[model samples]
Target: MAEKYLIGVDGSEHSRVALAWGLARAAERNADVELLHVADDSFLSESVAFLSEAQQASQQMLDSETAYAKTLGFTGNITGTAVVGHPIAELEAASKRVDLLILGAHSGSRFAGSFFGTRAVKAAATAHCPVAVIPKHEVSPGAGIAVGIDGSEASKVAIAYAAEAASMRGVPLIAVYAWMAPLTPGLEYLWSEELVEAQRSAAEEAIAIGVAGLAERYPDLTIERRIVQSPPVAALVQVGEEVETLVVGSRGRGGISRLLLGSVSHGVLQALPCPVIVTRATA
Candidate 1:
């Protein structure tokens, strides 16, 4: 069976972009797409005098979205569901039975914070499968694929998943490693040429280790290695501008100190122009 793409849409502009992206991807892969709109009763009180009218309006919106999905060439099997409850809960439950979950970073409302607001962040962190966060702006074609690695077990899993995706897409896999310099303030001025060369050599060696490991598993896969001297999030966003997808481990050597999604992952998801895939280390 072909993979199923589940997209969450809430009538927001960002969600509309996500719907388009998911449909396009489904069309390309010849897969089915499911459009879900969760209606939380908590946000809409039953005490309202026009509750019946509100429900009717919501149903009409869902019908229109369903029709829009069909117009986008999702002929295989397109479904639009309206459920009463929390948006994140509904989406998370739906993800358990689907191959992939595509979500919008943020809505157009001023109440919504960054791309990965509280709800989206929680859903992405605990979803059963891979979740791709789509940005709102129009993306150019052929952005390639970028993967972040830190020589940890979790990062190894991320690299494997990224390698397969890049191979399947027939695109170059850019393996990026971001490291920080020593704490010494005047290191460059104090250190001799030999020290600088040694540091450079060490950095190259670490990057080579990661590349060698990947090459052993995927001998035919084409990959490019980049070692940048900066924070992981900064380096990733700088290189991610030209990548179609950015794949990263849900948790890496940095561990959970940064929170459920981690600061770097959250930052990349918020700023990257392309879709960001956060893969589970165990799955």
Candidate 2:
């Protein structure tokens, strides 16, 4: 069976970008595309004309998105559906069975809702599969895939996902690990150059452990491991800017905040220059 991707559409240019990006990816993967829209009844008053008109408007928006997908050169099966409910709830329920779920970084209008808020955060955190957040610009394919790591199990899963994606794209894989030594501003000179080098070496070793055995799994993949002495979010954004896609674990586990996107992941999500995939760790 062909792979399946679900995209949340809301008739905005952001949604348009998501549709185009999703379709292009589907075209490459020969996957089926499903466009979903939630018709929030909160915008309607208790009137007959308001309800009927709202339904018509919702249908038109879905129609426009369906037509837009065709123009993006997607030859696979495309299905569009509009359900009446909270946007987050509807999308969450509908995305459970798809191979991937995609949405624009922003929704409706500048004031309507934000993809960085509860809707996207919760959806991505709880989604059964992977979620791709596409920005509101025409993103042509760039270099390879980049994955953020910090030696967590979630990061390991993200690396695996990114490796598969890089392999499929026939591009190199960039494994990024960001770390920093505890130092006081004025006391920085206390640590010798050897100490800094040791810190870096430790970080590099952790990264190697994180990416260990991947070469055997994907012999054709060329992996470039990057270890930087900086915050995780900053390092990821800097490296991810040059790549076509950035993949990270959806959140971190409990104690240190590692499940799929913790605070660091959220920061990267807000500042990322390109598309990002927040992948859940599978059992």
- For TM-score, the strongest prediction is 2
lDDT per residue for candidate 2 within 4-120, as digits (tens), equals 999888777777787788887898899998888777776668588877776777778789878877877788999988665567667667878799999887634652223334566
TM-score of each: 0.82, 0.87
lDDT of each: 0.73, 0.78
Q: Which residue pairs collide in model 1, if any?
A: 143-243, 143-244
Quick one: best lDDT, which candidate?
2
Query: Could you give candidate 1's per-residue lDDT for residues 1-283 as a string of tens digits?
Result: 8889888876677877888888877877787877776555555666656566555665666787788777776667787766555666677689888877888877445421222465666667767777888888776555568888787666676788788877767778899988876668656577677876787778788767766766666676789989888889999888888888888777622334323776777778767557888776663
Off by over 4 Å in 2: 46-52, 107-118, 138-142, 183-194, 252-260
- How many residue pairs clash (N, CA or C atoms closer than 3 angstroms) in each of the candidate models, in the order given? 2, 10
**Candidate 2: deviation at residue 89, Å?**
1.2
